[model samples]
Target: MISQDVGTRAISVQNVTKQFGFFNALSNISLDVAPGRFVSLLGPSGCGKTTLMRIIAGLDRQSTGRVVIAGKDLSLTPPHRRPVGLVFQRYALFPHMTVSQNVGFALSLQRVEKKKAANRIGELLEMVQLSAFADRPIDQLSGGQAQRVALARALAAGPPVLLLDEPMSALDLKLRQAMQLELRQLQRSIGATFLFVTHDQDEAMVMSDEIVLMNSGTIVQRGSPEEVYRQPRTLFSAKFLGEANIFTGSLRREGNKSLLQSDVVNVRFDVLGARDTGAGLVCVRPESITIEGASKEMFVGTEPNSVAGQVREAIFQGAFRRYLVQVGEQSIMVQQPVLAGTGDAFSQGDQVLLKWSDQAVAQIEDDTNG
Candidate 1:
């Protein structure tokens, strides 16, 4: 249970578990989402992100526990009866209907007044920047346009919460990126709680106000994007979110500070606690490491939090360069910005000294099974 309850919760799933015969897809998942916040369920496929979303949306019933939306318990409620909207990856627009008609489909079914429905449809189309394409057939709309139509339709009935299942997965890279920002902006402007599910880490980082990272049918971690990225709690969180350089060492105390002792390198950090002692693992992100040319007279082993290494591979990644540095038996990655006049880039086979601050080294549990 990861309770994100700060104020009023727009969506809450309490001890919800779903099982398919012998298989447990979601194991005792509990989450709370604040009102008007864009929360993303981020994890790899088969991690049960989509299944959790389905349970919250009333598309699937939980084997145990309850589902609450806006103070209402809807554990056994059907999809239509729940006050939630759904948008799928495939757009799911009607090819036979025009954009306006599709957007108004929910309104018509609800028997909203004709003039009121038209006004709502126009506003939704305008909100998604597709008012000009209102009369266009779904088949004639481009991929991005069709996606907007689907969003507008979902928003037509004005559901308090929206559950989107990898809605931008079908688009190309650039379009997908563009839609991520657009969707985030739309969520903020409308002030509706959005529960989004996606396998793409970038998508979750870009669009979410809070990222609920799930794995193996349980919530691994949940926090702001920067919080999750900077201070990962477990080995899986560190490796799954981004590239991590992992080290195994024994914890030793020097005065009030704690140090990680290893054969290849030694790391210094603030004292964690009594439970953090003994054999443990720590992770350092690639960008946290700084690299410089090693001097012949410099003794790298004597320097604190520094290691001597030879560059094994240098990768040019437009804005920055990624270098894989070989230190004894292990490889450490170092990333540096491409400054035009700096002439500081290291090449393959170059001898370098890698260093990082003690604050950058984070202790993590090696939860391999998760």
Candidate 2:
């Protein structure tokens, strides 16, 4: 099990806010990251995730609030004085310096002896698995190699906190996956607190121990990957993490069970005895839906949770077949694995039943207007 108590908190942000004239970039943001933990700030563009990160790194000042790192108040500390390292989206390496010199640049600035800095650089290069490239120039390395160099450089000063801002955004899909695994392992071995910023949900889900999701200058949700994915509290979060079909309806409670009622359908949903107010939204993942046979006997005694719709379009997607079905004027998407004859089984205009268990539905706050 991962240790929650890492002696002391690595970083803390309380009531953090940033503004530029009439625009508020961040608003009342607060969070705590345990020492040696990997936490990610995830959001779309213009969400202030970058602004929050910059605040923590002391590169940008907050309009109001306190930022503490390693138990020291950083309100008056400049970026250079803080025990933090920042890796940018671009590699930001010196074109003229070799890999070893680049990683040792920070140590050199601190007036460390040249021999000791060289020894530390050698060790860091080995830690990042780039020892063989120590003598190579920055222009001679691949994108992934350059990223490793940047990481080694950031860690050279042994900072207690490491901040990465979209470090892998420029790599290809395969290379990005490879680097994610490498970076996670590296973090474990070094035991440094990491605060990563990313717009990609998949990247955050794969690498973060806890994810802080932000939108429009405020935090929307913060939790583990599974917790956030399984129980999205807001409509924006449900749709932002992945593709989801949302249905707005009223919820009725009868004794221990609850039922959701809408104009097109009424579905029984599982909820833990908690009272649901008037109108709410139900979110269903595409992969959770199953298409049943067209025969009436197939759904003979099924309850109101199931719906029958006609297929409007079907396309083979290598591993799975994607089908678009029309229920009234709304379109619902269903995905199923493609077997040898599965594609031929369903055609346009064919009737199919879309079935899902009540436990698969997640209720979210309806925030369509705001």
Q: What would the per-residue lDDT of candidate 2 be over residues 1-370, giving only the tens digit for each residue?
A: 2123422689988789999998999999988898899999999999999999999998999999988888777866899999999999997999999999899999999999988998999999999999999999999999999999999999999999999999999999999999999999999999999999999999999999999999999999999988888888899899999888787778887556677776655666777754566877788888888986575344322465677778899987889888887766568788888778554657888888888888878888855565
Tens-place lDDT per residue, model 1, 3-46, is 33523589888899999999999999989898999999999999
| Root-mean-square deviation of candidate 2 | 3.4
Per-prediction TM-score to the true structure, in the order listed: 0.96, 0.92
- The ten-residue window of minimal lDDT in model 2 covers 295-304
lDDT of 2: 0.86
Q: Show pairs that collide, candidate 1.
A: none
After superposition, the stretches of candidate 1 with alpha carbons farther than 4 Å from their true spots are: 1-7, 272-274, 296-300
Which candidate number would show the highest lDDT if scored against the true structure?
Answer: 1
| Alpha carbon lDDT of each predicted model | 0.89, 0.86
Q: Identify the runs in model 2 with alpha carbons over 4 angstroms from their true place.
A: 1-7, 296-302, 338-345
